[model samples]
Target: MKKKYKERSARFRFWRNIAMFLPGVIVAFLIGFVGSDHPIEFQKLFDRDMLYIGSIILYLIIFGIASTYLFSSRQSYQMMEATEDEDEAYRYESQTRRIYDLATIFKGVMIVPYLLVIFFSCQKLIYEEKLTGILGKYTIPLTFLGLLLLTFGLEHQFRKTFKQIYGKAIPRNSSGAEVRELIMSMMDEAEKQICYEENFDIVFKLSNYVLPISLMAIFLVGITFQTDILLALVVVSLIYVYILVSQYKITKRYYKE
Candidate 1:
């Protein structure tokens, strides 16, 4: 019993450390760049053609993250269901699985905005060659959307994953060192599955979140860069309305069912 308890404690601490550290790592590494003031050699951007190339890089990063989340969620759920379970484990898995499914749907819905951004990013560089001249016009909102999905989606999934695995591993009636070891093995499998699900959901959610904002930026560029500001605004507004409505519809479907 003591050995089992120690092993479980060690495992929890490790995963807990990971759960806490990964987000901090992202914040520290990515956000830290903002304070660097070595004077960006604008000449580098010009010479390297980063403007065009950067778009591709951004898109690829977004796609990678989003796909990872989607794949992870489903894979984790399958892995979890493969293991032993109590009533709590089964219930927890069901809830977590559902959330993963919803995240997948949200990921798919994000495409509407992503394609728009690509279209507009291209429009500004290749088609129109005009700049928005404001990072807020595109980047701010994109960042917000990504953060929103990442924060809420990951937390929700993590809670579910932890609850299911932990709950299943230490049932009140179970006994014996060998039995405990078996439970430990099952817990390990469950943990892997949950982690995968969480990551997969994040990819799609993050991608979707940024996709809309990028499109919005593209629309804004049309207004800021060219002659048809009024028309661009109208088109942009309509697209915005469309996205909101789509989300509302999606929400209704899942919220009720």
Candidate 2:
């Protein structure tokens, strides 16, 4: 059954790729259709540098969504194995899974304009215009804010759904396995009613999605803009390493007890 499901998902992903690309191509061409009579300054917004900047952002968004999918999928597999009740497991799985889908879809929407950015920037076969750094402008920060909002909502939504799916109270006095099950049940319930549009869920989703992608974006943008590439790389490396260390410490402690 698992193999069958995997096969089906592969097929779905195949079609989904096509679905992702077609709309993007169409939209890029449409946006690329700029007026010819505009002054140079007016045309500058649609010029090469801004276009590449937008492209970098779009790339970050796609990479972020894909990462979110993998992260959530790993989480789901673990939780599913940890879960005792099939119904509750499905609820948990779907809730977490949909968030990934939402991110993927949102990223796809972003890629359309990004392609146009590439088209416009590479028009003269060179990086001629001024490459504006991400912090120098407001768009990346604004999108970061969006992701922040998504991540916050995602966290709270899961917590809020705890009571409905699991017991009224978690089994504090029970065995560890029982407590684990109880918590998983509640978490699964929370996962079921996930709202991608909700402010908190958006925030929650953003928390997981943004950091890595932001790091990658930082590296890529820093390079393209001829800025502090080393700083960006160092920061991301430190962050990911810290997270890994924390995970190891927690798991070691959990098993030690």
Badly placed stretches (over 4 Å) of model 2 are: 1-41, 45-47, 126-257
Backbone collision count in every prediction?
12, 20
* Candidate 1: residue 58 Cα off by (Å): 2.2
TM-score of every model versus the real structure: 0.31, 0.31
* Cα error, candidate 2, residue 172 (Å): 49
Q: What is the Cα-based lDDT of residue 236 in candidate 1?
A: 54
Judging by lDDT against the true structure, name the best candidate: 2
Lowest summed lDDT window (length 10), candidate 2: 158-167
Task: Write one digit per residue (lDDT tens) for candidate 2, span 1-257.
Answer: 11333446777978987785575456445535642343234344464555656666665666566556546655665686689999988887676656545544654465465555546545633443442556444544464555546444543443333333232654435688986666455554445445323544554444455665676566445433445468767876786666556667758988996
